[model samples]
Target: MSQDPSTEVVARELRGNILLVMINNPPVNALGVAVRCGIVAAIDAADADPAVQAVLIIGTGRNFIAGADIREFGKPPLPPSLPDVCNRIEACSKPVVAAIHGAALGGGLEIALAAHYRLAATDVKLGLPEVQLGLMPGAGGTQRTPRLIGAKAALDLMLSGRHMGAEEAHALGLVDRLGHSNDILADGLAYTQELLATHAPVRRTRDAQALSDRQANRASIEAVRAETGKKSRGLFSPLKIVEAVEAALDKSFDEGLRIERELFLQCLDSAQRAGLIHAFFAEREVLKAPETRNTKPRAIAHVGVVGGGTMGAGIAVAVLDAGLSVTMIERDEAALARGHAHIEKVYNGLIAKGRMTTDAKAANLARFVGSTSYDALAPADIVIEAVFEDMAVKQAVFAELDRVCKPGAVLATNTSYLDIDVIAASISRPADVVGLHFFSPANIMKLLEIVVPAKVSADVVATAFELAKKLHKVPVRAGVCDGFIGNRILAAYRMAADYMMEDGASPYQIDQAVRDFGYPMGPFQVSDLAGGDIGWATRKRKAATRDPRARYVQIADRICERGWFGQKTGRGYYLYPEGARTGTPDPEIEAIIDAERARAGITPRSFTNEEIMRRYMAAMINEGANVVHQRIALRPLDVDVTFLYGYGFPRHRGGPMKYADTLGLPKVLADIREFAKEDPLFWQPSPLLVELVERGANFDSLNKSE
Candidate 1:
């Protein structure tokens, strides 16, 4: 309205009947103070102009409004907050519509709710996704959306904050129509003209009630509390969301709105909100380094996997599923046949789950080439080595690949906890050697820890990131070290769990504690699932390399040695429990721990779940600090991303390091010091944590250094 750079709204008069208003913020058209002020002025202009009978608010580029800038959240809500802005829009006498495109999310959807009518572009998405950041929709979304859709529908939207396409949204009554951007505008304008001719806008989304019964809404609240309590467990956002939705059901529209606002404010001020938002922003920033985005990169037409083990087979399936032709090499035809059979078994199971159609399975299988020859990699743009986790064997594979691969082909090692520098030492083009550590079932998990050793050229790092994007995975640019980032922290965390077992906690008890803390599975169950043999080997390797630096629990080793490997062995931490789906903690494991503790003259003491969670987490956070201190990670946020996306740290808790911030860095430091005094071997704090605590700083502050 002031005609300033940020204040001016890009408006076009539409055929003397409608004014198409576009918010002109570049990149994502975020609803900032300037944009909100401009919109308020635009509504005033529309009322004053004789030619503009109707108004349609739209966006200029890929999205209508992705959301308010995250930078603006957690700060005080700017005066005339999003709710107030939407109220102004709703109060306008002229018919107003929202022509949404891209992602109309958070505050963006709240603005659209203010309009009397709505139309979204075909490909655009809509969601009230503040819950992901530990906040709910603050700007009247809780009030108006239930009025537009049902209370049940609104609860789902508010609680999960999941994205819905325009088509799905139309079916759900969240949108009035779905079409192309211009078509959506035309439809919205025509609808507005009909309203004008009829004397007033007829359909306001604010009047639709969500749930049928008062008791039913209360029941819904109870249901969500149980669900989120089990699902989120340690996290706080979902439970708060349940309360906000209950407010919607129990109170009047204005009263419900007041409650929603109160809850949103509470969450905004909470450390969880700040932590989750930090992680949210850091994840988007990970793929946006100068080396990844600024350089010219080649397209990946073909890929090669130089192994036929479970890891290699999974990697090949992911590549083929991404519509890239893949050739997998094995030691012989028998191994190739075995790997191909494994792939078939996985695909068949997927088809059974309705996740993959027969046609999709056929296509993916068709794209896979299984062979035992070096010539299979002739056309590969990139080659990933998913061989065994042995240094000498990996060196041999790389030596062979060096002779086989094209001059510029990107070569990567999918090694967990191995030295990438040592792997590259055998290669001619060390610049081209990067580590692409994919978690098992590479196609399913989103985390791809991209290890960029110091010797890796900027272009190679860029190419690794570009390839990760093509594979549709989260690429974390981790510096080279043992286990990179995810497994490195995992190593320490598991050590804590083992330490607990050595003290009085049983395997099931530790599992219960971890799952209670929001991890999907407990460490012992995970170790069993990951093969008890793997942990046994890593322990021996670390033990052989260094003196017993920690209170090493030898119980898991005994289980492995007994060939009670895990779920695969069906007798590791817990027994199969006879025809039961999952195993329970073996009495034998407890007995084993007792025997080991007695043998070492160790006094076994009881540990509460809180202490188990504390020590387990302390080990992880301390290890994360060590990782950062050793330059094995790019930033503290990188450690967060590694855990959140890659290692199943609850998104609501953000990541382990972010969660530590909520726990207070000084408190965590104190706990570590207490443990160090108890046993200086395993409980010693990393220098980074010690310095941060000495400086009265947090991991959030360390993230700033990046």
Candidate 2:
């Protein structure tokens, strides 16, 4: 059979009465225009050929189809859209069987739903994850998914944007069968032949009766809408997804598709969509560090973690989870035992949650070795020190690591604010030293700031990135500095929050405003959760170097002085009565604030939530710009990714840098300049922000240049 001249993305070959239609687009087979056209052309050809009685569609490589081509985002729609292609596939006279493997998501799932039958490989992952990109399914996904699976299941998959295993998909009736064989094509061909032999009829998902129970479907739709409303407060696409699913249950298939397309277009035009798409692309872009371009990562089989405090134990757990053998060291045997217990507790919790088997936990722990001796780490490929934040303590730890580690072994310090250069200088081998700043709860947090000191080798940086990938973490290359990227910017913004708190706004009001702006929690809430003492300690450390001209907010220090160190102490800006996870506003804290205001001789004024956020975002963006300008971060997107993954920066608003770009550089600069009138030293505009505003450029332009 002759291939379509328009595109080569789809190839067709006749296997007896079955015509094999293969998606040849490599690297996840994104359903771009060419692929769409190719599929429609192949379907037409198959229908016209009398020799073809059944059709089997499969992808060439690892994935069947990942999703719509990200490259096509923000571009004008091309002819033979995904919806048209899906409709054509469903309308084909010959029965079509979709054999899915490796990430059949979004448009990929839609295409599968359009087929008469779907056979998924045992390892296949299926989902409609368009809600993550701030868009609902534009094709027939919304309409067909609920018709194939139940309404509740379809909505759950789409809203959560979570992947389901092949068995789950088969159980949900999204897939007809699950293939156990390793060879996908063999299994697919055999399944297709079975269908032909049985004279299977075309079973369009749109014609299915999965959503036949009107009353039940309505209840499920309403239930999902209520849950989504609470969970996705500022998000736009989730509610739209609910609406589309509702349309599927209430309206005809074609009418439901029409509504889906309209809602999809609405989401496409939303600012949230722009921000989310930027976030999606920025994540991939941030992984490309200059050091990783040509340099190969050193093989890391065994890891050593120094110290067994919370941070240390967390890092050890993360390392062990990455399938690396870990040797954890503490100052004494008791501390080592505590660290071992901490690791065991995490696995035990997983077992209790049914997420892990006891056998699996035992097997993972078998690779772990806890010791009090520094000599135990001699066989380690890389040693990460997660001891105290004090410089002298870190220097001593690095000295031990330098002396004990073998040649070319990566010696990493997991310090949040300390200078890696100073730590490297203290060590004998500075070339092998790098800073790996893992956020609190390292095993769960996704961000890993790979802080590169001047003396560290490129291979070491590359190895850090490789390690991050193995740990299922997002790696951002950061130049050595106080707090590196995320925390430094965080300090600036948190200072902004402190300024607002002292100026007029209550901590609760400021927190509420921050929440309204899209963060999962307010700055004060995060401070409480992380323990206010952490920041207080940081403040005390910088006190000697802190500029006297800058306005200092003593409210936190006053609170800490009372031994009210946040959630742990049950009292901070908010009171955590009975160790409640959520805190309530404390009237006594207000009394403290009033006393501080009286002492400072400041007349407090009311501030709106909008005003509060304006200052908060201005501080964050200015510091982010300064980070990019000073080369602490390679690009603006690096800052964006760091905040998005590390900090609780809202993913829907994108990161601080992307938010700045979306909010307009001029507006942010204007806000900074205006705030400068009150606190010039604190509100000083970033030179980079000024330059970008003057040149009519945005942070994204800097990202593109990089």
Candidate 3:
């Protein structure tokens, strides 16, 4: 340990003939300027010392180095850039060994790749994940990774931004040795001593012949390019990563390094990079709300899930996977059996795919219990009711939970649209009643909307957020409303699509435009997958209270009347022939749209893809602004995080609110004013948006003020 406080971040010690240099930057040991300069000075001193035969580099904390200091992003360049420090280490006379424990990512992985040898713990994850931030690695990662591993492997790792385990790294020759012990220093020192005894030559990754089969690798590179182009349609960084890796094989190492730096700078200058970075920060920011930040969460261990249907089963699986005991309650013995089968089916699928062993499945299932009576849930710390979506049904379930569950046990409803406040008011203990709205296929999706009712206590809300963290779900606090955050915004935008279809655009054209805008699928396609019947039901439910003067399109209802629900029914707006997953456009839907337009006495007009997106995004942003203005969402970033995680709002655009801020709120308000001439009711700009535009402020201003 260093006695001097100034030099404490990087400490050096001599262990016999080998020099041990450990980076002491806490948390993730990010590669800031100070750490970079410290490593450079330490390496220079190690080379000058006559007694030191080799050098071993490791981190003092959990991670070797996670990445660059993100706080320095979008700032002026500092002295001793990461690439410069990497070059200095690579050119050192003595062999430098990198001992990676937790993560070696981005600039961290680049530093490791530049070392003479690499050793990693068995659970360590290594990657160049800069593409996730809309930038390729700049510190010679593109040039050095391909030289250590083949060109195809390096391109895949960089493009997908996926982490590789230590065993996989060793198999790919990226890590020279795999350490079994948790002590990274001991394993690294043993390897260093063995290398010195064997008189092993210093292995420079830049001089390696890993990419010898350039022609054969070119085919795979082309395949990956086509795949990335399809998957990452509107993104800039993945393609840039492909270019950088291709240069690695086709050009000299120094030339490849130059190309990587140039492409990385280009990504940095792009707007997509800004949006992605905002998205990265906004996810963490959404959890810092006042309700949950200061309050301590109630302890929760055992979870009770009511219902064994799709959503209920998925929630059960999620809780069980989080290492909490689960008790599933159903109404009867047959229903309990069905729920048990549903849980078993999920594990059985994983077993058939060789993703899980029989023992692991058995162990996971052992933590799960199924009962037909609600009395079995008496011991649960939290009980979530995933019953039907009707108000009466949810009320009855909560009443039963109130009677059977223990005092202080959290009682939650998973209703997507029904008013949670009504459900809370029906129960005697309203403080325990909150909404834990998990999206469809809850185990797979990451978003969890925590709906806070007027009667719910602060600690209960805090407990829900704590449970979200335990389940590895992104929890967004939402005030109790019809659809809360995601579904409410979704309803607004879907209506916009409907109005566009009646006015000018075809459903297929609108969907195609949305896909072009960066979403994996368009609104109509998502409707088809989720079953068109769901929207039909919501429309029918609201028809009794809907404003008569408000323009309402009946095309979807007309289709639902014909029993063409969606993928499950084999027919919808699109056709899914022979049980196929993807759908083809149906002419009948166009006829229905035309008939609806004729009934409304409207002339059809042509809408370009750009126009469609303008209208689509305007409605989304307008509704998101309302969500923030109404305090349904605590801040604008909360709305952004909700959509980014739940809905297929593209991460590259940084969700609707962030995208609106990037486009300038004044421009968005202007677009809304322009559209209001056609339909005054729907296109009326949000008051907060109009107020912000007049005050020369932005939605981010609201985020910061909150």
Candidate 4:
């Protein structure tokens, strides 16, 4: 074995006529500067050595190469760039083999494409997922992938940023062969030796004939371009990917590479790239809560879910999907049967969609136990209360759990707005109580707010995070507050929209502006879809404490009072005829709004879409700043992740906090102050926002500090 003198990351050893080059970077073996240089040096050594007839490249750890080293993001350019390294490998006189195991993504997959042949382990995952980070593959990935797999498949892989398993990759011609052994090195050596014995000729992806049919390639490119335009509306990279793939068909191989590199640079320089990179890092950072630092999560095998409503059944399904056994308790046999039916309905839908087989559904259902009695939950490792959103009702559920659950079992609440600290205080095991605020459609939504009360133990918090990972959910640690991070900020921003509606803007106009700003739907649309009665109930609950002097919008209340509780009843701020999913503009709603404005003795004014977004974003950012300052959220990124995963905040803009940073804190504060001039009570600028602007700092700085 010989280590390259320049860098130790790459090592080479001669095995008969084959030279094995191993990348020794730990973890995912991200392609850093040293690794790039080392690979070039090793390739050089193999080409010069007489004993080495073929070179086999493989990583030593779990992954072949996950991607670029994220630590080097936004840093100065390093020597022997990934593009150069890929060209070196492709230019080697000797045949090169890449043995892919685990994840071979982004630049890593690009390097594999540059090799003469590719062998992947059965469990290997391959993709060019740079589009997720607001980048198309820079180092020949765009130029070569289409040549290897054709334009449609390559564009699909890059655009979706989804991992293709080994079988799928082999079928798509992305992988030359699939290994049957557990040891990647052994599989690679055998494959390389077989290639040498056969005297196989060098195969470069650039020289492939996949793009020989120019007309077909153009057709595929245009199809993808149309689809991308519709789906990736505000995104910058997906369209560039289509353009680069088009270049591969229209330009020469070398020229195509040049175009790819140029487009990649453009994507890298885009503000969307900055926002996406921040979101990428923020997701990983949000999981690192102070409580989870040294503390170990408790072992959770059997989960108990209280109630049999939609949220409860969803939680049960999520737990079952995570491979945990669930014991569900309902108040009565009819409700228990409904919960079971709900669980089965999900599997039945999956079955109908061909995503799940009958056997798989049966297997998952076998682990689920449902009963009307609470005694059935005695053996549960954790009991999650998903009852009504009332303190007294939640207290009753916890009191039962405290009496029946096994010692050390985690007690969690799925309350959306109730005070969890009060619920914890009412129970005997206050230390075991933690809030696991799963969003509606709990099994589907990615966000899980792990609300930590004052009395909850660190281990319990850690356990909640662990549970989140098990359920394939993004966990954001939240200090106890009325609505926690996402909902609290949501309430503030939704109020801003309501204020706009009552002042001059129509709900339809505000919703359209919000959608134009990248949210999937506006606050009013969301309220309607979620059933307007839900928010109406919350309003009535807080009505007694509502400030008398503050402006109030009674339009929603009036709509609900007439039994038109949104889509369920087919009427809201918008009309949904015959239970249609999309609502239409309602003349009655307009009349109601005009009457309300007259009742409040306020004159109506028109708002431009841009003007509407300014106030809406100002409200969200100001509340997000306060959330971080009050430690309801540990950092700004936590708030970002919460909204990104939960509230349909556009991933391209990052989250509310990240959007604020990109928009410039001073401008956001200015907007807030300007709005405050009209309604100081509603637009009270967050002190943290004001402080950050005074210091010329941004939310990102606070993220770095935490």
Candidate 5:
């Protein structure tokens, strides 16, 4: 082994006739400028050495190299760009072998592709995931990947940005050998020695014949373009990826490299790229809570779930999937049996769809037990009540949990919009009570709003975050409020849509406009999927407290009065015929909207899609600002993350707050003030928004201050 402090990022040592190059950048070995230069220097030294017959490359820590250094994003270009380094490695005179473990993604995978041969551990992951950041791989990945694998296969890997395991990569010819040893260096050295003994020639991927026949793959390439066009919607990178792949098949290697570079630069300069990068950072930032930063989380082995309805069964499944034993309690024997049946039906559906094996379902079910008695929860490390949303029901459940749960057991409530503080106070051990608001279909949704009450301890908050991590969920800390962050904001924007419907715009038009903004479904479409009865119940609960002077749209209530409760009833805003999941526009909804507008003594005015989106976004941003101002949310990014995960906020626009920041705060404030002229009650600008605009700052400034 050789030691050199100057080139510590990329260390080198010679083993027999093999030159071993190890990238020593810690924490995933991100390819920064220093690491890129070091790799180039190491390869140059190996090529110049007379005794070296083969070169082996690997990473020092847990990962080979995850991707480019995100810290370098939006900065000035540095010398020896990644493309230059990759080309240098590919042009080496001696045979080069790359031994990868952990994740070799984006530029890391691009560098590996430049090598003559690739070997990986059985547990390794390899991918070109740059498209997720709104950019395709720039460093010859577009040109070289299709040459190793066909254009269709390369497009599938690049466009989806999904990581492929070693077994799959080996099947696809990306990896030549799989090592079973944990000692990657030893395995790499052995592979290198075998290659030297066999006298393997320096095979360049640039010379591969995988993509030489452009005529043969033209149909496949066009099909990819059409599919990506629909799937990507407002995204700019997926189409660029298609163009680059087409270049690989139709043009020479250098020509394709030129086109790829052009397309990559276009993606880098796009607004979508900036938004996606913000989203990527914001997701990581929401986890850094000041209260939980240094606190030690309590260990949880067994969990107790109260309730066995849809939400309860989903929660139990999520817990059991995380390898925790769960005891689910219901009100009676029949209810408990139904809950057990609901959970079993879920797994059986998965098994039927080939998503789960029979043995896996049996093992998961083994961790789950159903009972009607609260006494079974005595051994639980934590207890979560997923019962009815009513205050009385939640309080009674918590009281029972307080009586039966072991001391120090954390008590949590899965209330979406109730006052969690009151619930905590209802319990004997208020300090151990927290609110864990899991979105609908809890096992599938990523967002878990961790509502911390006034008396909860810091360690309990830390434990909630730890639990979220175990369940593969994103946790955002929220203070007690009527709707917390996501639902609070959701309530505001949903009202705005209702107002728009009464004014003139149809629900279908509003949905199409929001869809054009890149959401998978608009607000009404979401209501249909989730069932409108859920919203109807919430409205009925809040009807007594609603301000008399505020504008109320009764069109939705009119629909629900007829028992048209959305997908469940085959009718809501749109009609679902014959139990179909999708719904078409219904003329009856137009009549209800017109009747509501006439009854309110208001004249309807036509609204352009552009105006509709502006009003909708303004409403969302105004409430998001209030969420931060009231301290219901820790930071602006928390609000962003909640919407991004819970609701279908377009990730390419960042979260709503990030999108507001991209649009200047002053502009957003001006829009709110203008809209206030028509309805001052609903369009009132948030004090935080006004303060931010007056001080010439933005939501991101609040995130930084925190």
Candidate 6:
């Protein structure tokens, strides 16, 4: 063990021929800057010792360095890059072996590749997932991986970002051997001794004479270019990965790494990386901003859930799965019984699948207790009001929870768009009221947006973040505002879609445009699936309470007025014959759009799908800038996470806001200003965006300041 906790690296000389090196950093063994330095120093120590004939590198805890400390990303990369470390390791005369047990990701995988040989524990999984985070592996991954695994295999691994288990890795020739630890030091020592005896003269993978096959065929390179052309349509980096691979195949080892670094630097300069890094930081930052840090929290072991609707049932199921005892409270016998039956059916379905054993299913269900009274809930640790989204009714529920619940009990409301501060004002203990916005099918979706009202205590924020960790969900902190960050950004973008509809674009055309741009669905289709009436209800609420210019959409209201309700009503954008869910666009709506355009004496010109996509994305980025200016969301990544997880953003495209970085700020501002000429109030460029554009910056540069 090292002399200090801050810098810990396990080291020992074994039997005069084996040098055992282990990373002993506690808590996930994060490869922080200090750990990196320690590792470099350890390698120096191993090299200087004449007694050391072989070195074994392994991690002490669950696994090796999970990845580089993501916190350090964008904040100037540390010296002694993983590739440099790997180069030093391989160039050593003594054979180096990597003992990988759990995960060897990003830098971890890079380190393993640096070693002359690698042995794996049977359950370990490995991969290079930097592409997912808008990064290609910087440390010789593009070069060395292809050297070990062929070009085709390496390209798929880099592009698809799929991970493999130990056995699969062995089958693919990534791992030299797979075994369990019979005796910790003994196993690694034994492996090292066997390697030392072979005198195999550690073959540097970079020195391989040939592919043992031929170079990539012409058709293969063309196919890769075409695939990248489609996949990274607007972005520059994924295709750049293909370029790096091509360089790897054509150049010498040193030459290939130089090409890899060149490509890596190019990606580092990209807006996609900036946007993605923004999103990555936002998810982490939201956990402890001052919104709910001081509020006294109740012990959340037991929760009383009110409402038995879809939201209620889902909340109940999630709370139970989190190992909290749930007393599901409903209005009457029918609702109570229905809620119980629904929870049972969900658990039963899980049992039917091989996912959950019958015994485990029963045990999980036993944690749930359904009742029809507020009397028993008064003593519960928490009471969550997952009722319908009506302010007066929600206020009444808050009043009831305030009256019925014990002191210090957390009073939460699961309202998607209502102001959490206003909901908190309804109760005397306003600090106790916070927003817990769980996406539908809560257990399946990983995002849990925790919104803090203006007067919320710091302790509450910490508790919420901690609770998110316990639930195994990513908790993003949001400040009090209408719809918080996610929906507020959507409000502007969704409204833009409606305006585009009136401005000579069809609903189907807009939907197709968005889907082509990489969103899972178009705004209109989402409105239909989410139900037009809900938008109508939210609009009516805004109309009654807020200013006329409080960012509202009315075209959908007119559609709802005609009873063109989505899905459940079986007639929405398109007609749903008999039992179909998604309907075709109704021709009548085109007539309504035409009539509205003529009534307003507006010129309607045909727009190509390209213009529609550019406008929609521009609107979303504009709103994201507005939200950041308003300080509703901490950073750009928070907005990215909001859209990516909540709104079904194409993961590979890296969410809308991050995707915008690829479009460049100046171009987006130009487009927004052009749109503003058409609709002054709606299309006015965000001041934040104007400044960013003026500064020739992307979201990433601004985020560094945050």
Clashes of each: 7, 0, 0, 0, 0, 13
Return the TM-score for each candidate structure: 0.93, 0.99, 0.97, 0.99, 0.98, 0.82
The alpha-carbon lDDT assigned to residue 120 of candidate 1 equals 81
lDDT of each: 0.81, 0.91, 0.90, 0.91, 0.91, 0.77
The TM-score of predicted model 3 comes to 0.97
Give candidate 5's whole-model lDDT.
0.91
Candidate 3 lDDT by residue in tens digits, 218-331: 887788899999888889999998898889889998899899889999999999999899889888887875678679988999999999998999999999889999999998
Of 1 and 4, the candidate ahead on TM-score is 4
TM-score of 6: 0.82
Question: What is the C-alpha lDDT profile of model 4 across 258-349, one tens digit per residue?
Answer: 99989999999999999899899999999899999999999999999998788999999999999999999999988899999999998899
Give lDDT tens digits, candidate 2, residues 1-706: 9986777988889998889988988788999999999999989999999998999999989999999998888899898999999999999998999999898899998999999999999988898888888998889989998998888999999998999998788888999998979888999999999988888888888899999998999999999999999999989999999999999998899899999999999999998998899999999998899999989999999999998888898898888888899999999988888888888888899899999998888888999998888999999999999998899999998888888899989999999999999999987889999999999899999999999999999999999999999999999999988899999999999999888787889999999998898888899899898988999999999999999998998999999999888889888878888989899999999999998888998899999998998899999999999999999999999998998998889998888888888889999998998988888999899999999889999899998898
Clashing pairs in 5: none
Q: Report the Cα lDDT for candidate 6.
A: 0.77
* Range of the 10 consecutive residues with the lowest summed lDDT in candidate 6: 209-218
TM-score of 4: 0.99
Q: Summing lDDT over every window of 10 consecutive residues in candidate 2, give the lowest-scoring window.
A: 3-12
Backbone clashes in model 3: 0
Question: lDDT (0-100) at residue 499 of candidate 5?
Answer: 91
For 1-706, candidate 5 gives per-residue lDDT tens digits of: 4545667899888888888898988899999988988888888888888988889999988999999998899999898999999999999999999999999999999999999999999878889998888999999999998898888889999999999999888888888899979988888889888888888899999988887677767877999999999888889999999999998888899999999999999999999998899889989999998778889988899999999999999999899889999999999999999999988988898899999899998999999888888999999988999998899999999889989989889999999999988998987789999989999898889999999999998888898999999999999999898899999999999999999998889999999999998788989989988878888999999999999989888888999899988898898999999998989999998998889889988799999999999999999999999999999998999999998999989998999999999988898899999999999999999999999988888899888888
